[model samples]
Target: MHVVTTPTGQIGRQVVEGLLRAGEPVRVIVRDPSGLSAEVRERVEVVRGSHRELDACMEAFAGADTLFWVVPPTPRADSVVGYYEDSTRAACRAIGARGVKRVVTVSTAGHGIETNAGHLSASLAKDRMIEETGVSFRALQATAFMENLLWQTEAIRHQGAFFWPQPADRVLPVVATRDIAAKATELLLNASWDGRGGVPVVSPDALTPDGMARVVSEVLERPVGYRQLSLDAYREAMIGHGASEAWAQGLVDMAVAQNDGAYDEHHRTAVPSPTGFRQWCEEVLRPAFLA
Candidate 1:
């Protein structure tokens, strides 16, 4: 049986779908079972309670041949570092105790790179720790999610511009979430024991703010422009929106890193997915942009 920690998240849902397609029995770790899709809710057994506690979650993981581990951090958590460190450590400990052989994880590339322990640093730190769990693991290193554009929707409606953190022409690697999901699912379903190490899942193309603007404008037939904010401007804007000072500043700093190529390079050859930016625009972002 396969056990999935986040059966409802963007990538996690796809992983479950992939397993179901193969007619494999699966289990999901859930704090509450009601959120699962009826198909999954009915077919899969739920191991209730938070994964933050090691023993309970490990018990939930027992007897699973493979596990899909994902953590969606809470922005307003009191201690961000401990939240990740503890939760991820718990996952690793459980996987070890349970002797689950194959593990697939979704993680970021730049986080492993030297830099921001303030924010990026802790994520990279924890990712390294998770990799040491001794399971046959594939940690997907990906770029900024294209879905982050959704954060700009209300602004696009009111301002006719995207107030991004990087410079207008700053090219950052951006990949579709569906592609990330697909790649993750492919790894989980294969279970071929390829005996490989970390896998980097990147899109065919890396796009810039201007590049993104061009796509959006062409797709939506609107005058959408890119406006990159200064670090001070970014800090003030985020703090004004109620983010704690440290949280707001760290986010701005990370954006600067992305713009300067601090998070670029160190990628793998593409394993192409059915979707691309334009198709994403035509299908998802276009209607939202038009709306």
Candidate 2:
């Protein structure tokens, strides 16, 4: 049996589709099954509960040979790292008890080069917790997702500009979530050799904010600009959006760490995913912006 957590998430839904297309028997651990599409529900076995719960994990993991694990984001959690560690605790115990053969997880780049990188640090910590189980694991370490740009669509449409905490000139590596899902599906279905390691999924061309603006400009047929928002302002914005104080602060720290070249190592070594900034902007961002 193949068990996939967070099956309705952006990446998890794609992973489930890929596994189903390959004719693999799949099970999904979800807190609410009604949120899933009827097509998806009919195709896979559903274990209705959150992966963070011990009983849910134990039940979903039983008799499963491969597991697709992803930590759902908790923006309002009091402690970012604590939330991650608490959730991972149940998964580690469940994996050990079930003796699952292969585990594939969504993680970030800059594993060793960074510590205390807010969400990145929490994700790396989650990797370590899973590795301790001695189960075969593959961590798909990706940079920021191109889909993240969708969040700025309204600003881009109304003001012809968007803001981020990172320097406007810094060359940032990013990947498409589809590529991340494809890679995860490949690892989950193959049952190949893997002790414990990371696969960095990045695009071939690095993009600066100014460069991103150029692509958006060309795609939308209107000039768009990038502005560097102060980290203090970004933190305030996050908090205003309902994130806890600690979570907001962690995001500020993450921006600072990225600016310091945390993703540089993996971007240089890893083979790039096919989607580029221009392609994603044209295909994904353009429609959303128009919508």
What tens-digit string does per-residue lDDT give for candidate 2 at 81-155?
A: 898899899999999999888899999987453477898998888989999999999999999888888989888
Q: Which candidate leads in lDDT?
A: 2
RMSD of each: 2.4, 1.1
- Candidate 1 deviant stretches above 4 angstroms: 117-119, 194-196, 267-274, 289-291
Encode model 1's per-residue lDDT on 107-185: one tens digit a residue. 7666334555345555665677766776787777766777888779888778888887787766667777788777777
Clash pairs of candidate 1?
116-121, 117-121
Report lDDT per candidate.
0.74, 0.90
TM-score of each: 0.89, 0.97
